[model samples]
Each structure stands twice: as C-alpha cells, then as structure tokens.
Target: MSDIDFVGLLSFVPAILRVTTPILLAALGVLISDRAGVLNIGVEGMMLSGAFVGVVASAATGSAAAGLIGAIIVGGLLGAVLAGAVHILKADLILSGIALNIAAAAGTTLLLFLMTGDKGMSGSLASQVLPKVTIPVIADIPLLGTLLSGHHILTYVAFLAVPGVGIFLTRTPLGLRLRAVGESPESAAIAGINVVRVQVMALIVSGAFVGTGGAFLSMGYVSWFSQDMSAGRGFIALAAEVMGHGSASGTMFASLLLGAAEAIAVALQGRGLPSELMQTVPYIVPVIALVVYARRRQRLLARA
Candidate 1:
C-alpha cells in the first residue's frame, strides 16, 4: 500500500492498546491466582458476571463508579465460589470452574432479561454505560493523545497492572507466601502458610481484576453488554498465565501479542478481509508463542 496505509498501520497502535486492556487485566488476574498455585478456571465466568453486574448497576443509577464497584464485588464473590468449592469442599478445580463459567453465561443472560424486561436490553439509554474520561492536556496532544489519554480509565489500569502485579509478587511478604504456595504447597504448609486462605485470597484478587476487565468489555470498550461478550478471553487469560510463566511483565507481553493479532483481525474486518481468517488470527497467538518458546528452550538446553 501507500505511505498513508503504512501510517494507517500505526493507527493499529491505539487499537492494540484498547484491545489489549481486557486481556492484560484478565491475564494479570490469572497470574496472581496461578502464582499462588490456584488454577482459576472460572475467570471467564467471573468476567461475564462482572460485565452483567456492571451494566445493570450503571443502567439503574447512571453512575460509572457504582458499576465498577458492583462488578468488583460480584466478580470477587464469583471467584470465592470457585475457591470455596476447590479449597474447602475439596472439589475438582477444573470441573468446578467449568461449571461456574457455564452457569455464569446463563445466569448473566437471565439477569439481563429480568432487569430490562428485554432479551438483549438494547435500544434503551438506561442500558448504556460508563462515561469516558478525557484529560484536557492529554486529550489535546497530537495522535498520541487519542492512543493514550482518550481511552477509558480501565485501559490505564490494565497497563499499570503489569508493574502492580510484579511488585505484589516480588516485593511483598504475601507475594512470597503466594509463590511459595504455588511452587511447593507442602513446603508452604510446613512453613505455617495457610494454604487454603492464601488460595482463596488470591482467587478473590484474581476475580476482582477479571471482573474489572469484563466491566471494560461492557462499560469501557463498548457501551453495550452482549451475550458471552467475554468470548474466549477468560480462557485466553489462563493461557497467558501459562505463557508468561507467572511474571507480570511476561503476562503483559503475552497480552500485547494477542492484542496485536486481534487488532489486525479488527482492521481486516473493517476492510472485509475474510471473516474466517479474521477469527483465526486471535486464536493463533498462544499456539505460535508456545511453539516458538518451546523450540527456543529446547535449543538452549541442547546448547548447554
């Protein structure tokens, strides 16, 4: 294409940031839970629940903050359910999480109908959501402003979560305990680390972030909450945790790669590039990353 199209590729930068926000946040959410040795398979459910709760609250009160609070609380509670079933009730985590996610999908949909008396809850301003925050100087800047300050507050939070999670995992005592629990639960238990408590706490934190990320889907990225709007992002976040090896920066990096692929798919869609491949791009990221990294590791081990 021409130089303008080349510049148009740069437009994907903002789109990347916007698209990456939810993934990054959800990835970070899984990072903590995974680090603490808890497999948070219910992230998808938590996010879907968050999206539903956030939109319903915002529609009722017309307040963004209220929606955020509602999402976090509901998300955390959903996470607690996951943690309780596995930790206290000694349930199979994978099965429990999958059940929760299935329940959340149907639960949120049912709630949407009950609240709005409509199936989709569209065509009404009451169901519309979160206010955008535009800083004066930041919004006035050139192209960068739209790419940066023009996004919702959740976008900034997703970016911040990288270092935030890093510090929490490295600099804090709780971080050490979480890691200890993850790396060696027996050792942590011997050391008097309350494994169950730590796992439940981590799940709560993870759910909070996941919920906030879902809120981004309903309130920040778009003004409407649709059925299964989270799509496969919650599972993608779990893959991100595996890909990142439990590091915050690594999680963000994984999220960015996925986000870039997704951005490309979106751009392709606007230009009517085959919808089949458009769907494929987003799904390809973890596969490619995992394969490449595995090969690299094998080579490094062979060299050593």
Candidate 2:
C-alpha cells in the first residue's frame, strides 16, 4: 500500500506540470488583454486557429520553428480582426468572440479537407510531431531537474513568461498605461495612452501567446489538430484571470492550480475508472469556483 502511494505521487508530479502549461499560457494571454480593459472571448478560437496553422506549417515545412512562428502570426491577425470589430466597429465583444470561435472551427475543417483530404486533419497533422528535448546534465538532477528541464522548449517559455509578464505588468510604463486603460478608457485617453490602440495591441499579443499555447499542444506536445481541441480552456483562463484580481502572477498561480486538478482527473482515468467520470472532474472545478466566487463577492458586498 505504501509503495502504491509513492508511485501515485510520483506520477502526479509530471501530470501537474503538463496540465499546467496550457491553462497557464492561456491565463497569461487573457491577463494581458484584461489588463487593457478588453475582455478577449476568442481565446479558444484563437488557440484552435493557431493549432491548425502551426500543425499545417510544421508538416509542410518540416520545421517546428516555422510552425511556431506561423501560429503567432495567424493568431495575432485573428485578434486584430476581433479587436477591430469590438473596439472600432462597436460590435458586442462577446458576440464577436463567439463569431471568431465559429469561424475558427469551420475554417480549420475546410482547410483540413483542402490540405490533407481528411475531415478532421488529425491524421496528417500528427505525422510531423515535435521531439522532446533532454538536457544532458540538467536531466540527471533530482526533482528540480525533472520539473525544470523535462518539458519541451515551449514549456520553458511558459514558465519564463510567468515572471517576465509579472515584471512587465508591475514594473513597466507600458504596464501602467495598460492598467489605466482597463480602469477607465476616458482617463487613459486623456493621459495620451491611446486607449483603443493599447487595447488592440494588448489583445493582439494575447492572441499570439494563446496561439503559441495551442501550437504547443499541436506541434510541441500532440502534433494533431481536431475540432474544438481547445476544449473551453479559454473560458477557464478568463475565470482564472478574474479570480486572480488582475495581477499577472496571481492569475498565473490560479491557472496552475486548476491545471493541477485537471492533471489528477486525467490520471484518474488511467486507473480504470470510467473515463467520462474522470473527465468530468476538470469541468466541474470551474463551475464550483464560479459558485464560490459569487458567494464570496456577495458576502463582501453585503458587509460593505
């Protein structure tokens, strides 16, 4: 019994990190946009588009670098379109987001047929997958080595982004301007921050990172594209952003926390539990969080 406990704990460590990456990356994306007072609803769509573009590019070029680059570019463009519709055209942000997600889903499906003659494009895309990188010396170290050095280059980038983003948002002038815009666009505009410009640019960056996150899944981790592969991760990211109260580091921590729950759920499936039941675990956390968050807010408001 003790041996089983040890092995289960061992398995959980890797699972936690692996699950954390996608949510963490997505949370950062949303954090950037929200900090500018624009809610980005197209994260899942952007991620899906990035996944398709990245996989297609990598398969065609036989280079993971090209794939990563392509995903960022495509995602940025999508964000720009979304921003234009919302900030410029005065379209409803939520509606625009939903439209983009629908477009991403259909566009990818069409491209799959045109590119590889497959409906899902899951097959051809999976053919050109990224290889795991093993650091020679670092990999030999104990727990630190495995957690820090065991993942793909993208995983390293995700971790690096945590502190970098935190510093960028807290210590930089740009960060100040972004926050000002989020707090009040009119005030930010008076301060010469160009609220629209800041929101658009920040959301574009958000899309790029989210795209890269999706690319990590398709090109870096699984190397396959599927319908709605993002699986509502965008929504979860938004929740994390709100829960973290607009701080980059705080949101990142929230993302990782939810990610850990997802990892355990996935592991539970492998233990011969009903896969559907295990899968429900990840989905349930967000619902539970929302209820708790609302209740807390109510209490605080009543006290006030």
Candidate 3:
C-alpha cells in the first residue's frame, strides 16, 4: 500500500469515466422506470439483447450508426413488451423481467452461434466500431484534454443524459403525472391520469436508455459482442439507482464511485496484491454504498 503511486492511481480517472458510461446510462434508465413505479428487473436481458442485436446489425450493414439505431429500436420494443406483460397480461413484473433476462442470455448465445459459428463471441464479424469524439476546445487544452477528450460518443451522451433526464423528471407536465402515478396509482387514476399508459411509456424510455448502454458495450466499448458481455452491469446500475434514491445526477455520482473503484482495481493489477480480491473491488464498492445509503435513510427516518 505504501509503495502505491498515488498520482499514477489518479490516472485511473480516465478509465473510471470510460467504465462508468454504460452504468450511468443504464442507471438513468432504471431511475426513469423506478420513478414511474415500474422497476425494470429485466434490464439485464434488455441490455444483452441490445448488445447482440447491435453487433448483428453493425456487421450486416457495415455501419455503426445503423447498429446503434437498431439497438434503440430493439430495446424500446423489449420495453414495450415488458410493459405489456405487466399491464395487459397481468403478469408479475419481477418474474416477467427475470424470464426475459434468462431468455436474453440463452437467446444471445444461440444467435451468436448461428451467426459466427462461435457461441462465445462475434469476434469474426466485421462490425464497425463507434467513433470517439474529441471535444473541440477541451481537446486543445493540455491536461484538460487528456482528462476529458477522446471518449466514445456514448460516454458524452451518458453525461448529457444526466441533465436531460433530470429536466424531464422535474420540469415536464408528463413527469409530474408520472411521479403522481408512482406515488399512488389509484390517486393518479382518479385524478384523470392514465396510470397504465404512464408506466408503459416510462418503461419504453428506460428500455431505450438501457439499449444505448448495451450498444456502447458492443459498438463503442469494444467492436464485438461476447457471451454475457453485460457481466452484471445491469445489476450494478440498479444498485447505483438505489444509492441515488432514483435521482439522475445522484445515480451518476454513485456510478462514478463504482467506476473509480473498478478503475483502481485495473490499475493495480499484478502489483503484488491479490488479483482475485482486486477484481472484487468494483462489486464491493456498490455493496458498501448501499449499506451507507440505508444507514443514512434510517437515520433520517429516526429523526423524522
């Protein structure tokens, strides 16, 4: 620990930003659905489906943009399907989401095998990678550019979404009704709001966000899709959402914390520390954050 270069570890800031992008986007999705009273437990499946479909579309069309569009469409459709299952068919949301996740995991693997003759990954596919953006003036700056420029376009989108989602949830009439529905569906319905419609719309929007994050994995984070590449990111995003109390900016902060921990684990590799333990750091941080959040909530409740 004493030998660890603190400044060198600080370089993990860039890595933290990169790793946090997917989680930030996904957590924003979770925040929307949660605020609307529909917790999307199938976010994992939604993300996996987007990743698989994004790679397939990119490889087929030879365009990363097309791949991203395809992912958003698929993700939105899945979101609608999830909502329909809960609202129309009266299925339990949690069970339906878990089913979708199971299906996505197996479905993606089977599709990968059919497409590339390899069930593990789409490495052989000629998928285009999403372009990275170098912020104009920021990129010209010395240290600032090094810290802030050259990230994938989706990373910038994820940060931009923080404000976008915040504004939507706070300033819009629809957002007001959505919150009303979440707080009390019966009251919202009596007040002339269509509870079902609001919940469904929130879920579809959440799906679009989750899909974008999924595409970031296959199209931007890397150039190919792999089996279960989401690697529990959907769950981590959920944890972030909980830690943030469903606020967009708050979720972003929690995601950054977790991302930084993961980045440090990566930076510390092979440095005489236990590699297995290091890999657990990212996961551990979320658990700790949740515990802290719960304690704070308890303290607030006690005071009240």
Candidate 4:
C-alpha cells in the first residue's frame, strides 16, 4: 500500500481500540464467571447499572475515580444478588439474570428521571470523564506512536488484563479451583472444593470487571449517561466470551474483531450509505463469526 493509504488505514486503529475497550473488559468478566460455572447472564444489566451509578457518583463526588469505584461496588453487589437468587431463593439462573436485566433498565431510567427530571438523558449532571494516557517516548514514535499512545486509561487496563486474566486462570490456585468447579461441581465437591463459595466469588469479580467497562462507557468517552446507554455491548461481550473458547487471550482477539466491525460501521456513516444498514454491521459480524466457529467445531468433532 502507498504511504498515505497505509497511514489512512492506521488511523482506524485508535478508533478500533476505543470501541474494543469496554467489550474486552466485559468479555474478560464473562470469562471469569463462565470459568466458575455461573455464567453471568445479567452482565447487560450490571453494565447499565454501573454506567448509571458511575455518572451519579461522579457528579455527586466531583471525582471520576470515585465514580469508577462506585460503579465496581454496585456491580459486585448486583452479582451477589444474582447469586442469592440462585442459591438462596432457588430461582432459575437464566430467569434470575433476565429479571436483573429488566430491573436495571427500568431502575436506571426511573432513578435518572427522579434525579434530573428527565428520563432520556443526564445532560444536566456535571459528571467527570476518565482521563486519557500518553506514553511519553512512545507518543513521539512514528506509526507506533499513533497505534499505542494517547488512549483512554481503561483501554490500557483492558489490554493489560488479557495477560493478567490468562495468568489468573491458568497459573493461580484459585484459578484451578474455579475451573474445576466449572468442569463439574460434583467432582469439585468430591475433591473438597467449596463450589458455592468459588462461584460466588467468581460472579462478584465478574461484575466488578463489567462495572469498570460501564464506567468507560460513561466516563471514558462521554461525560454523561443516558437511558440504555450500554447499547447491548454486554451481550456482544458475551458473544466474544463464547467465541474465545474460554480463554482470556482468545476473548481479547474476539473483542477486537467485533470492535473493528463497529468502528468500520461508524467510519462508513455519512458516506452516502444507509445509516441504518451501517449500524447493523457490528451485530451482524458476531452472528456470522459465531456460525462459522460453530460449523468448524462441529466438523472437527465429526472428524475426531
């Protein structure tokens, strides 16, 4: 490719990363929960709640960091509630998750309306956004600088978390127990592992990760939160986790692929193409990828 063409192509890198950050973080969270056999289907709700909480907290405290913390804590509490519904109340896991999602949607909107007298958005709140980070030397480099430097702080955390999550799942003692529980709770229990405790912890940690992703949605790019601001990113993250085949690194790659699809769609807008059609690209990519992966897996299994 020509230099100009290459540079033009490279310009999309930042956008892709920006789009991928929240998905990657939430996908990692899903990975953790899935590894423990709980499979947090309420991730969507947790993310929405987190975004709402982050905005409200940041506005109240005038501190972005405080907002992020509040988001994580609320997310963890939601996870715990899910756990309680399943283990204590004997509710079905899937149904409980669905209820949580429903509740979050209505709760956030109601809370916003009560707080700001507006149900659609939070424009009146003086929320703080998370800062971007610039690597000093890297920022001065040629193409590498543009690719690596000057990203939202959460973007770095999301990428760094790939390796961090991998190590936690593969190298740590708790990781082993978590995976063992996922594989077979009966077998894990036979081995003296506390399956309930492990799964509870997994869901809580999963929610915290998801909450951080929500904070990015509100505080990373926009300084405010809106009704349904999560925009189904949590569901996309679930697809990423499924495509990752239960691996953190794989999940990261899946998130990047989905993010790229969305970024391309955004880039294509106002270029004379149908805006509605372009908006579907991100969702379509995941369905196609999942189908292809499923077919491949089936073929491999048949051959084996």
Best by TM-score: 4
Q: For model 4, how does the per-residue alpha-carbon lDDT over 182-300 read when each residue is reduced to its tens digit?
A: 99999999999999999999999999999999999999868998999999999999999999999999999999999999999999997999999999999999999999999999999
**Measured by TM-score, how close is model 1 to the native structure?**
0.91
Pairs clashing within candidate 3: none
Which scores higher on lDDT, 2 or 3?
Answer: 3
Best-to-worst lDDT order: 4, 3, 1, 2
| TM-scores of all candidate predictions against the true structure | 0.91, 0.93, 0.95, 0.98
Where in model 3 is the C-alpha error above 4 Å? 1-10
Evaluated at residue 236, the lDDT of candidate 4 is: 95
Misplaced by over 4 Å in model 2 are 1-7, 131-136
Q: Name the candidate, 3 or 4, with the larger lDDT value.
A: 4
RMSD of each: 2.3, 2.0, 2.2, 0.8
Which 10 successive residues of model 3 have the least lDDT summed? 1-10
Alpha-carbon local distance difference test for all models: 0.85, 0.82, 0.90, 0.94
Candidate 3: tens digits of C-alpha lDDT, residues 152-251: 8999999999999999999999988988999999999999999999999999999999999999999887889999999888988999999887788899
What C-alpha lDDT, on a 0 to 100 scale, does residue 29 get in candidate 4?
Answer: 95
